[model samples]
Target: MEFKLEEFTLGPSIDTLKKCKKADLVVIAESFDVDVPVNINKQGLMELLIDKLTEKGLFKEPAPAVEAELGALAGTPAPLQALPTQTGMSAEELKLTLRIREVEVRNRELEVEAMHLRLKAIEMERGAAVAASPSATQSPSQSPHDSFDVSRHIALVPPFRESEVDSYFNAFERIAATLKWPKNVWSLLLQCKLVGKAQEVCTSLSIEDSLKYDVIKATVLRAYQLVPEAYRQKFRKCEKTATQTYGEFAREKGALFDKWCQACKVETFDGLRELLLMEEFKNQLPDKIVIYLNEQKVVTIADAAVLADEFTLTHVSVFSSPVRREPVSTDRRVRSPNGARRNVTASASARETRECFYCHEQGHLIGACPTLKRKGQIKQTKTPAPINLIQIQPLSDKSTKVVESKKAQIDSVFRPFISDGSCSIVGNEKSVPITILRDTGAMQSLIRGSVLPFSAQSYCGTDVLVWGVKMSVIRAPLHLVQIRSQFVSGEFQIAVRPELP
Candidate 1:
């Protein structure tokens, strides 16, 4: 395959330069009015002519495609053809011919080497040019490919809500514009980025179906429509009840209107004001106030507001300024450090005198008395020293019976159980075995309700030393209980049973 430089650089702008023959290319270059070489071979002649034309700026360098083809040709050598019959050739002439052929091969090799270096230079220049272009300064989102992460960018934006469809869609449109996404893909991207109820409505679709932005908008609108109109109906029905003040009624109606507007995407300021005034004049306020307002011929919201304020001021006393009283301290009496009670009737001087413990002076006491100091009579009184008592005959050698009680090292381990005061209290009604769980920390003992109506003679108060603390207990007498085939006295504590209603 052969390609000419003029094909891409200066030849007619058309696809597939192979359609034009070499002779036609030559003719085209000659027609450019440059001097043409008469004796050069076809390949070399064409290269030289192109170089001259490029130098004169009549033709540009070849395109990258042309340069690639040139490089491939440089790497591959032309096939060798058989020489004509050499029957009459001398030996010396044949030797010279062989030398010339060898030199031509070396020249072609050198040309190929030079072509490679030229191609490398051209590639570096192209790269530098692209790097310096303004388009290189664009952000990833503005790039002409799928380079930016769409999901990550959308995550920063707020999710859409059924009530806030208009605002959400408007913001979405701005985002899509900034991203420069095509219209066909807008709906698909929105569906992918949907959240909340909007996301639930349009679950993810396949890429083929996701491209329909119209379908996505329709689906979202339909979902929004399905949102209940109960708020709107409530707003319409809202009125000032007999007990509700004008301010309270207005606040309730305003709140309901705001909710309805948000759900319905009703954002016009004039429309909202008109709706509020119409509802107020038509149904909310009292008939007398309405008739008075009509008599005054009030029309605008400003006039209606003035009338409402006037009516409230005249009829509602709750909004009037409250009568304030003088703040008085409720404290009855104050005590001085010297145990003197100073009531509210006491004068400041009397109170200060009461605060003085010794001389009854208002400003200074007997110890801190300036008058006594000036008189040189404020002497420090010495306190009596405490006498030390010696130990008398080692506390008289009090005799104590030291009964040695053996404390066997019982290595018994048991898991602690929490008792909910539901254990059965079986007294010695018969010689049956009964289990007793003793909690030394229990505040009171529990008794079964069936063994109620305790006898007054059986109850006795006793202070038992438990865990080094004297704990009060109520001991009651029980019938005889046998333990290990021996009769032992059994006793239970008296417990109160709650009376049933």
Candidate 2:
């Protein structure tokens, strides 16, 4: 534990302090006139001793012999003769302890290196500020490049990342400005840090163009597809990620928008407004419409609007209904049996004047009158002979064939209703067997009260049109009825008629 004062004029090295026990550390501390706190641990005591000794200019650099020994220990196992015997520790234990301490020392060295780098960065920043200031003085012979250390300044910049090329360049530019790095050497510094695709892009350029930082940066960005269109697309499609906060997403979107604006060279308010309006217009349009506009290479808003309107008009015409027209009469006059000329409009006038004899309705004959039919008062009537009727010739074979074909077409178009099935209506004390007609087109089912075996009590009366004849019918609540082998239990309308047709 005792150290000779002459040999220890410069205090023991960190390695030597690490190897010593607590008692040895205390002895070393005393020799250096360093205070030893009673509560201090071995590690703390060593640090205190080292600090005090170094402050007093007593710290010593490791001797050549110690350096050689450390190198040997790191590369190969230590010899038994070199292991300390006074510590009462085995050779293996001491070697393990030394290896662990070596790791700890390496870690501390890394930490110290980081601290030095940070301090160097701070100094560079200060120097840059002073050089930029108007009040600062410098000799005419001295150049700004004299203090510009490319290697050191480059070390402060992060490596180029393919995925984050924009961000990496942003950081590079900031650091270069703070360190007062010469613009002429920016491309060289950037070239050194390029990796992956960025490196490929830089290497692909000619040496002359490669020397220009702008050229190199533009090439790199273009190679990565970070153009104005790309930025705009990213801004439009950027959605908030689950892991990202709203603030982060907003800032990211803003950054992308700025990059897009810069890339597009939108400097003035008008240019920015036009660009924004165009993008918003495209976004608001349907995907198909947007694609159509893109395919047509529409540049102006007016052109897009015109094309959209044309497309809409064309499609609307395709699906629109055709206009219908009333048939025009070609006949102007008719010839009578005596060769007297008569007007065709006179017959139309006679038909307009004609009225139903039963109900006095102008539009229909007595046979077709709905009131007479609904009242069951319709009767067959003979047609009176005309005072001045034209003698009509027999029908032509062609005309008779045309009439028969028309009648057949009418029969084919209108489906005749047939009795679907038989059903029995059960009343208070009686049941009636009736034919069932299933009219899918009819909204409500109606039963003739004249056909019912028992009397039906009318509840609420409603007007129903049967066979183009309006008639009053009442809703009759039937308890149960069997139809088509199925029991139907619901309300049924009972039409009060004289008899079933």
- Candidate 2, overall lDDT? 0.59
- What does candidate 1's lDDT look like per residue over 1-501, in tens digits? 465443333222333333545575565455445565666565665665556655754343333433334335444322233334556868887667655544544555664455556657878999998988856677765534355556656564556666667457768888778877667556656776677767776775555455577667756766666332456677767976534567998999998777766654556877567545654553445555656675775546677778877987887642222324433223345444334554433233433444455555575335456666666653553222211111111111133222111111111221132111212223324332222233455544333323333443333433222121233323323321122212223343423322210
In model 2, which regions exceed 4 Å deviation? 1-149, 280-501
Per-model TM-score, in order, reads 0.24, 0.29
The sequence of per-residue lDDT tens digits that candidate 2 reaches over residues 1-501 is 553322232223566667778887775665445788889998899888878867853343333434345546344323233422335757787567566556644654464455556657878999989888843566776645566677677677687788898778888999889877789888888899898888987888998898899999999998999977689889988987534567999999999999898877888887787777767677655455666776786545777889977876776633232334443323454344334554432133433567889888786556457897767643543222111111111122355575345435433323253232333453343443343444455444545544544332233323433332233332333223333423353434433333333
Error of 1 at 209 (Å): 5.9
Q: What TM-score does candidate 1 get on C-alpha atoms?
A: 0.24
